[model samples]
Target chain A: MALINLAHGFVEVFQPFNMLMLFIGLVVGMAVSIMPGLGLVMGVVLALPFTYRMAIEPSVILLTAIYFSGTYAGCFSAILYRIPGEPMDVPMLWDGYTMARRGAPAKALGWALVAALIGGLVSSAVMVGLAGPMGDVALKFDSPDYFAAVFFGLTTVVALAGKSMVNSLISLCVGLLVATVGIDSIYGTERFAFGVPILRDGVQLVEVLVGMYGLGEILTRIGQGLHIEQPKETAQKVSTQFPTLRELIDIKVTLFRSTVLGTVLGVVPGAGATITAFIAYGIEKQYGRRRHLLGTGVPEGIVAPQIGATASVAGHMIPLLTLGLPGSGATAVILAAFLLHGVQPGPMLFESPASMLMVYTILASMFASVIGMCLLGFFWIRVVIKVLTIPQGILSAIVVMFCLVGSYANRNSMSDVWMIVIFGVLGYVFEKFKFPISPMVLGAILGPIGETAFMQSMISSNNDWTVFFKGPISGTLMAGSLLALSYPVLQQFLASRRRCAAVA
Target chain B: MTPGAATMPLRRLQAAAPYVVVLAVGIFLYIQADNFEFEQASGRIGPGAWPKIILVMMMATALWGVVSSALRAGHTAPEAVSEAEQDEALTQLPEIYPALVWIAVALTIAYLLLLPILGFFIATIVYTCVLMYLGHYRRPLRVALLSLAIALCFMFMFMRVVYVSLPPGVAPFDQLSYALMAAMGVH
Candidate 1:
């Protein structure tokens, strides 16, 4: 936390080899991000095994850098090809593609680069400043309070995400069911395997994500059909540069708001960047006409979500430091990394000098990554534009091949490929029906958290239900939810009635 | 976002089917769960109880969504374009999907066919080449070059340098991997 420690963090990564790795991480992660159906997870997964022999500090630094850079890299394609490189970058397709169509490819790419850099830099700084404090804050929470936090986190799927609260809840339930399919954590009894051994271990989150997001996407694509007219400007030249000050200022409120929102959201269990980005976008839009900036060719609009996206990742570490619970998606992956290293991350991690030093590297790596990305961003943006300019036939072919590789490379198994196909159909079906996928995904992620917390709360309370409501934290959270749920309905009804009165 | 793109009633029904199936499965689960440990008096609801609570919540939401979706159809024709729909090309289908699926299937089959015989490198190269083509790389020369690049990069980084247990393909590539390593000073 002191100046010297910050200096030490800088010295650690300033090594020649480490710096080179940063650049490689930036370039390759960006490349994967630009490829459809291959996003941050694939980028990180493929890069992970190679880093296993690496020292723990550098290995995490490399992976964490990739995690930050990969998200923005997706925006490159979303801008140029209207093909979102990843789900988190989906909103980019709205404005970036619009700008590309308007013959402002240079301006759009420039905006995207600037937005990404600012988003990354700001969020990383937030990480450096607030992680320790949040970790310090997390020290107060116990089992029931943690349970309440998880409960609120689950409800956030409805409160924060895409429309259709009911559908989100439905999806959440399905996820919990899936989460329960494996061995019971405490009793070691099998729940839902139906006698299949694979069910004994339950579905691996990696395989599930690959199938649900990757394979499911492919199936949905096939169901949509084959022949398609390509974008006319696929061959257009684009430039990447910094956005003007006015552009940065435009989303200042949004950036500030989302930074805080994401940090808070990240602390709670079960929330991830995808949720944070959407929630930030949704909330930012609600305040004014500025909402139109999103999904259109507006520079600041594109920056807002990216700001929130990166912050969510940083925000997740708070609870990991304070409560020993992983905050969100990538942090969950990091927790696994810690376990692999035989390092337990909990209250004492902050107390340990070596662990704290590593935390400094983890926080510092993002800044180093941002600089690395900025350097590579200029060059890779150009190269990727050329790649995107390839004729539709060729581009489609390459995407298809990578998509397959993405699925197959996971475990090098055929079942996963088939799983991807099945899920692709499911995704297409869901998309066709206007069913939101985030809730279902979030549900699956949160189900275990909810169930475990529920069990712990129940067991501790001896079935009194009082255990859950026993503490002020739980009571206050539950009370807050009641207000949150009803506020919107009342507000909407009043507005509608006011409109009628005006007309009368 | 388009007016005509309003979700078909049948589609809505289909969309809700997964939840209905999940609900039934949950019911079955709960029935089986009756025997699981739930010391309600002791404030220890069993795992089954926790799952049931979630499943019920899920059912309620799905029911609400299905009902609201139906009412939406009855009350309005869904002809209005909410602002979210503006500028969105609802009809334009992305070309990234079909080829991706076929390639996925092909890669799987290829992996299955060659994992025993061709080993990792051969299978990997072929997979990479096929993926490059599927990714829409038109020229065979370019596809070959890019695939070669990706394969070599991966082999060097993962297999040769890191000493990963790569699937040693048929004798030729196996020898070639060693020869390439020796030729390049890779140990």
Candidate 2:
């Protein structure tokens, strides 16, 4: 652990360019999250490919740093604009919007920043502490073990289901199916190309990722037709004070509890930060001392949700390191990034880990980016807040360009550029109707892993279906899935009955 | 927007119908393509079966999504407004078409022009300028300057260090790239 922490310090904060990237990530993350439509997932996804060219540590660090600051930046608009900048910022809306209306937008922002920064840094520390030991555990697994991890991750497709597991399942199915769209890898057979030479290479993960998240978001933003309201206050109407050390102490306990919760959830293969926030909200309502202060921009609520969300990033990496199962969208991107650079993740990754420094570089870059966020924060808010007023068309075009160049630049193929437009339309449609495009991207990312693992397990067992459940690890994971699938049903039932009783 | 409001399923249906149809068509194409396999598993496992399985999966999921939307619209609680009022009750946000449309057009144009002769670095600079304009950047000089600065920074960082081969340009700029490469310690 000492060596691990020491490695983080060894992360050469010395390079000005790498340091600049951290600052850039911090600034954009702050700005984009403040603007409507561009969520952290979008910011992270769009930014992922750019890192392919960077040294891995800096790349990962830059992306992780954005992941850190972007989530917090959403609160800025949530407080001032009565809009939740992104989905995770929704809880902040309740108290934040209230504070803004009450002429305390700045105060809400101040508290949120303090809470988010603390929450994020603490969770990152835990990640840095735990990643090495846990990653080492992954080194023991063989093909079957890899299969188990794939099995574990496949369950994550349904993680977004609010009340309908069936819809989520359908979405997951669609995503997996979409993965079959090109030349068959193993047998060299053309499956679904339909004579379009464009798709012979199969469904490109990067293209689909951008189409689904990036373009899908732009379309949704247009449909929503958002408008920014000018504030009446001439003096910026900002927060009164940053969270003082005394105030920080007051929220520290809540932060700790939330951090633990987030870390655990994040560590799980499928449960993302959204889940963490929802659960943290529930826990706060259940056990927080000032329960009445749940949504009133209370420091505890702000700190708790953030801790859970930040912890989710590092926790998500555990499965990625150990099982090669990406825990969430960013991890999915990380998986894609590794593959792009010709680094295969999973058991082989842990065995010798010839490219481990790339990942370490990402981690180093993440720490650097966080410090950069702090520095940028001093100036970013003053500038980025004005960006909110920029016309959406121009921004969308820039996004579209990135979407194209990003896809094209990956292989220097105009074919991929065209794929961007195709995916963009599909993405727009998916967004318009909320069909869960991420699942498809996730499916594409995990397709080979899932297939190879399933194939290996089958081949070893002579195509025996029963072999999928042979080991303790596999059994444990399957059992966990059954429990996860059932838990939500039971909760819904209980909640429904309580409502019935109240009505009666 | 008010929570728990139910609306006409037509909008949802209209939104989803196109995807269902496209996927359905894709399924048909996939079935036809399944027969075009390479001669006897050159590697491991015949190619046809896996792709076939994926196609069936995608079609099925899309169908499920269609059904789920229908179900959600059906089960929507009736406490707020009944089926009729829900249609008109939807709160639509304001549309800022100027920013969105121009930006999209500008991006598409830049991309089309950039792919051939101008090459990556020059193309990127031009594209970045157009983007800044689309972004409502008012000061012409600042926009141009910022665009150049951005282009230079990225060209050095991404194109040079990462060694992402910038598409070779025609004429003068092509020579410029060669010269710069020579100066930058490249063979």
The best candidate in terms of TM-score: 2
Per-residue lDDT over A208-275 for candidate 2, one digit per residue giving the tens place of the 0 to 100 score: 78877886666555545434454334335343357678877776668778878887788776677766
State the displacement of the C-alpha of residue B179, model 1, in Å, after optimal TM-score superposition.
9.6
The CAPRI quality class of candidate 1 comes to: acceptable
Expressed as tens digits, the lDDT of each residue in A1-504 for candidate 1 is: 544565677887887767767777777677766665446655665565445466777767777777777767777767777666666776666667787777886777777666566666766676677666665655665667767765665565455444555555665566667778777786666777677765677765444444455445544544444333344564445566566778667667766776677666765555666666666667767763477666667765566566667666666665655555554445555554565466766666667778777777667777888767766777656675454334433433344444444445445555545555455555555555556555555555556655677777667666667776768877876666566556456666897798689879
Which 10 successive residues of model 1 chain A have the least lDDT summed?
Answer: A392-401
Q: iRMS of every model, one decimal?
A: 5.3, 5.6
lDDT of 1 by residue, B105-164 (tens): 656566656754666556666776665455445578877776666656655654556665
User: What value of lDDT does candidate 1 attain over all alpha carbons?
Assistant: 0.61
TM-score of each: 0.77, 0.81
Residue A122 miss distance in model 2 (angstroms):
2.6
Clashes of each: 22, 15
